[model samples]
Target chain A: MINRIRHILLLYLRETSFVLLFWVLVLGVLFAHFLFTDLDFHQWLVRYITTTQYPVFSIWSSVMLGAGIWITCLLGWMFKVQYAHPRSSLLPHYRSSHLMVGWICYLLIVIGAIWVIHVGGSFYQDTSDKQFAFFVAAVFFSAFNLILGYISWPTFAVVLWGMLCLFSNYEYFILTQILGEFLTNVFVLILTSSALLLLTWRLFHLKEEHWEYPYLFSWTRTSQRQHDALLTTLLDMVEKRLPSHQKHKPLKILRWDVLRFSIYKTILFFSAIILPFYLLYIKALSEYFLSFYQSPFKYFLLCAYSVIVIFGFHLRSISLWGRELLFPMERKRFIKEKGMNLLIQIYLLWLFLFILIILLPYMLLMPEFLMTAKFWSEILLTACFPLAGFGALTSLRDLSPRQSAFAFLGIVTITIFQMMQIKNLDVPILLMESFAWLFIGVLLIKMSYHKWCQTEF
Target chain B: MKNDIIDVKNVTKCFGSKKVLDDLSFQVGQGSVFGLLGKNGSGKTTLIKSILGLVRPQHGNITTLGDDPWCFQESTKEKIGYVPQMDSLYPWLRIKEMVEYTASFYSRWNSNLVNELIEDWGLNPQDRIGTLSVGESQKVSIILSLGHEPELLVFDEPVASLDPFARRQFLKTLIEIITRRPCTIFFSTHITSDLERITDHVALLHQGKIMFCGELDELKTRGNLNLEEIFLEMTR
Candidate 1:
């Protein structure tokens, strides 16, 4: 029993260490830069703290609640690969207590870490926020996290998703005016209690899950002929942009398992990112063109900014581009093909997303913007720049999504914020900005081609 | 009252319209050592996967331990230990850790036996499964499968990567286990002698169809040739 617990603990710790390392390295640098070089950043953060509608206690508790929920989710997900196969349940005499205890240990560590982050960030905070009510809220949030952590991961995932939906789109659930106000105030509590009840049932009544769904999303293993055609079409498009000599024999498509798994693997990230937009769009429709911050068009521009950041960050999925050793194609040609593939994929994705967004509640929310040239321009610039830039920049060097995502978002946020201050963006400014982004995007892509040519896979 | 531990009936599996297992039906009796043999891409692995519920056959029913292999219950799964042709051990885990983790799943785990086997196999407990040679990785996988002392052990080309000495030792182990515990073993292999030495019943899978499923001795007597020659003739 001790041995099993020890093993589980060790595994959890190892995973936790990797997670911590990424955060420390990224956040440490971010803090150092803002603390030292960027006085304006400090000013902005202070302003953000002061201008928020919520009081300090509410603010800190809300932050902790979000972190607590996220941490529980992370812990629950850490074992997914290890426990994916149903065979993991075949152990006959093993009790669920070990798993329960392991989850408790994870919860404690996470709560501690959250507290540390709270304390560290509140270096210049007032002491009034540390009242009994604040403590109660913190306790409640931590306790809720424990319940979430101990539940079956699929249950946790579903509940978490539902909670996010409820929190984001609760207005839809507000059946009556009297109940709606009450629901808004204690929705977190309601969700926590509901999850706890479900988890209690799961732990005792429904222990030994029999129903295991196959992957929700999977890549179809297409025919070799189909694969070949895909490659040929990709090559043909790329070849048009390349020198005549670059038009060579079709290299054997090294079958990437990623071709089958990438979307499913990244689905969690996709969902988490898209959920807010889903809610915001609903709110926009509800308020007749206004979201919390701006008009739906402007809010979508912000999302477009986000889309560019995501494209830049994820441009360097090494698996997507790392096939230099597998094929005999020259580096330039390989990079060109890869770049075109990425641009095409991103363009298709963004096009689909943009169309869907406009077709939905946003259709009624910003009905006039769809017909406007300004909106079209916004859509084009959003799709074109990132698609072009990432297509090129990623070719130059393999980049990590998490690390690069942060840096790219920071740059995009700062630039967008500055640009937003300019109340009027005339046609010339819009054209100039759009053209410049395209120029820079294309130039980087061209440079990346040369850079990749000389480098190893 | 069918006495068979495994029963496959008209199992037709297709991959992109190409039939991998076409109307495949067979039975292996309780405590019998069954050898599944076929040439590469002849659907040996696919058949095994179908039986294990890793892959679903479009038109067939498979029962192992008298329960449906497709969505088999934990109780049923506990009775069977399976090793695939290729090493499927978690790459990130050390051999020892993997053993311990795998043991946690089984109703019955013979820790002493697992330890003895790992030591006998000369596999380092601390070595990550990924760092080991293919042969060494296979040994770890074999140990994990046997740790629970399953009533039925299935191996797909179990000793394909092992050296001659290890192969001989493994065969010896199999024989000893079968005699002592009266367990059923269903394994696939390219090795003819290994089949000839241990398998009481041999089935030749060809072009997704069973060409022969009968007593090994009867097959040899009927063919008037060694298992190797019989295999070649059937496959050809």
Candidate 2:
């Protein structure tokens, strides 16, 4: 049994070396921060338990929790791959015992991390400080396990949200309030830990997970063919609503726009639905954001801009051009019309995003603050660069989508840096930047047009 | 004897250092069931793709339907159908929807023929293409190609994914289409029995070269062996 366990451990290490490396990096940074900082680490721990806001601690804990989630997902995927297969499910490889062992392995790692933190701090800390550290670690670990359980069994998340709604004030359920109970009495800690362990055990023993196999197959496998399937599904959903089967022949150019715009439209729809709820969540946790900024609207602008720009880079997929190559169309007309179609989609997306940016300030209850002429100029100047840069990159036949994405990111970073270097928001500077962007965009577009005309499949 | 539907002359296609097709030459006669036999990586797919203008040969000339395939006119395209080896169908569309979408591209589409084939093949038109099995998706792809009723049909290993029963049914449909119209079929497959059943002429491609290009009966009579035996002897 010991040798078997070791073999499985080694197998997991070999398969999931990247996740393990990330875990080690997180712990290493935390230790370095704790050891190298001038502040007393023990006092920081005490303050973290007592205070509501500790930005540095919060960031570290979030990183730690994120690493925990990453490790959990990787381990779960390893087990799921074998069990998801039809014939492999009948084999002896993935058993309930193996699942429990995997979870226990994860649990031991978290416990070891807490132990190291405690041992490293014992030079100047006392027993009370020890208990505080233990309670905080318990809360973090419990949150991690609960989240995993909630994901494994989605009904639990619904019940959890319902329970949260029943409370009159969210203050009653904040992390410090939960920790206060843990620090004041030992019984609460024991009961909560037992309940978390019981939940984890139940989650690990779930046998009827065949329903999730299809989703797992697509999510875990990132092949070009699967990517094409995803694009096809998105495009078909949009195409179905259009009058595809009208009496007269459908406009091929309009159909082409539908294909190009499907991804952006779906993303924009989801963003519209989620952004409001996200703002409300930020409102509920206003104390956290209040320390960094007076209003969440600025963050919203940043997020919205980043989302639109990030999606712009993803619009041109590698395998997508292959789908249209076999169609019987004049090559020159196809190229010229494709350029027109792309420009139209880019303009439409720009219009929709501008309206979204305008509406977001109103939604966050800061309508007047962001309506200045300078803000408008800034938005206009920056908005088209991402789409233009990415669209021009799409026309280049040599770069793969991944390489193009990296290039887009590099260009975006340089442009942002240049904009940031400008101290004054003068009209002349804004106009110059906008015109420069236009010149570069048009130049790249022209170059790509010629390249595309000469390209063979 | 018959006017050639597809003509290839000294086609040489190279992928970097590897030569996939070397100075290949062959002619597919009009209204004939032509079968191309080759081993794995023997450039059968490359040759078919060249004929359909999906691939450009480095040094050669290919003409299909009396026009350069590289720059086939819209009218020429309307009269040609191609079924690629892998079915790259829109998984989100239903079989009926896929047929309609493909039909929109061609000027001439036979809806009655499409419906008849779908029904005869025991396929549900409402079923989503993604959820269908590999053989079912292949059937839909075959149906999509046949819907336009093209004068020339180019198939690259069309029966690779189909089961034996579906393959037999597909060959039967091919025979029916041949009897029903003056259509030309050019296909490549590994299944010798299926080829022997349907093909009138055969071409053996080995090491990017054609070893035989003639009537199946002539080759069989010369070798005094079955089609599979002849293929092994020639390729070996």
Candidate 3:
């Protein structure tokens, strides 16, 4: 039984890359938490039990523990029936007896474990306190064992375990609080025994069906074949329907409409204008911002920077939507059209920011605020040029049809660096940046249009 | 009588240095069923795709209905119906919606014929295309191709997914339609038995060239050969 369990687990770990990555992330997070946080396991538990202010933390912890228990029990149930029953053309009476005996033995082991834990925990402490903790541990162990047994089961085991864990934990927490500790322990004991019997009977019924469960643990071979077949089928279908046509033009008109209809830009404008004021209000409430009237430039710079950053993020998201190819027109035309649409969007975004910056002097009742116009112009010019340049570069790359996370990250990094290197707010520098970007953008568009024209799919 | 509906002349196609379809040539006549027989990777599909204007030949020309096939004008497209080897119905749409959408692409769509086909095929209209079995999806695809009442119907491995009973039914349906309309039918299949029952003409494609293109009965009479034995012998 142990060998079988180990074999299945090894195959599962080998087959699923996500499962391997999940374990790596889990261990990494645990190591980081231990290194940085002053989280003594015992001390944390004591605080969790005593603190009234940390109800959310306590609830979350209880939920996790409860989930762990339910899953363990489900695993235990599945483990007891891991071996395949002999295939008999006719009904066999002896097979039923063997299965019944196995279930009885499994139940007895579980009861024995609970008894041992209960006695051991109470040997050092008072009898009443032992029940709640022991019951929780036993249920957790049973659920885990049942889950392990159902290795061949599809998503059902995982989903069932999750639901059971959530419900059992919530019930335990609420019942312990309202009915006192003793009643909660008694209630859990009754519930656990009933669930075990029901699950055992269900397992027996499932075993009666020969083809219900697959004998093999590893799906690696089958999954690869399925994937290859699906790809081949898709390629075959596409080849038959769409004869390799030269070039796909991006629709300029559609791109403009998408830009005009963008909700992200609106959100960015609001976040820029309102977030700084909200932060200032919070600082005032906390009595953190002393002499706000004297150091207004610092606040202005912070607000402007936040607004610029928000707009930059919004532009990045807008750039992503362009690759959807909403218009089935030629690829070159589509890219050119989308490029013009992006330019229009940038113009509208910059105009809105400029007007907001221009109106700041009147709102603040300070003529000196007009001095910051040079900085605002530099910020706008620096931000817009790079954004437009990146958009053009993306259109040039036209990495549509296939995109990776790394490509998106690279685009973001370029946009941020461009925004960072702005020293002057003079008209010449702004115009020069705009013209340079415009030339680069046009070059990218032309290059992309050419590439798109040549492409066959 | 010059009974040909499709004519090819010194057709050659290459991908880089590797020639996929060499100086291949064949003629498929009107009101006749032409069977394209080949082993895997024998350029039968490439030839079909070329005729559909999906692939351009490097040299020579193909004329379907006496017009350059590669031009693929709407007028040419309207007279032809194509059933690809794999079902290409959009997965998100219901079966009925897919039928309607596909029918809308053709100017001369026969709704009455489509309705009769849906009933005969025993397809549930409300079910989504994604939920269908492979055989069911193929039936829907066949119905879509036949709905337009095209002058030339092209099917690539149409009954590959179907069970024996469904396969027989599908062949029967095809025979019925062709009998009534006398449209040229060109289909590619590995199942020679199915072809033997209906096909009047056969083209054996091997290694990017046609080994044989003639009347099925004439070829059999000359050598007393069945398609399967002939295909194996030629391919081997």
Index of the highest-lDDT prediction: 2
The digit string of per-residue lDDT tens for model 1 on B26-116 reads 9989999999988888999888878877677889799888987755676787788888777556666788888887776565799998998
| Comparing 1 and 3 on lDDT, the stronger one | 1
DockQ of each: 0.22, 0.01, 0.01
Worst 10 residues of 3 chain A by lDDT: A85-94
Residue B16 in candidate 3, Cα distance off native in Å: 2.5
The CA lDDT of each predicted structure is: 0.60, 0.61, 0.56
TM-score of chain A of each: 0.56, 0.55, 0.32
Q: What lDDT score goes with residue A228 in model 1?
A: 45
Give the winner by DockQ: 1 or 3: 1
Question: Model 3 - which docking category?
Answer: incorrect
Clashing pairs in 1: A91-B105, A91-B106, A92-B107
Strongest candidate by TM-score: 1
Best by DockQ: 1
Relative to the real complex, the DockQ score for model 2 comes to: 0.01
TM-score between candidate 1 and the true structure? 0.62
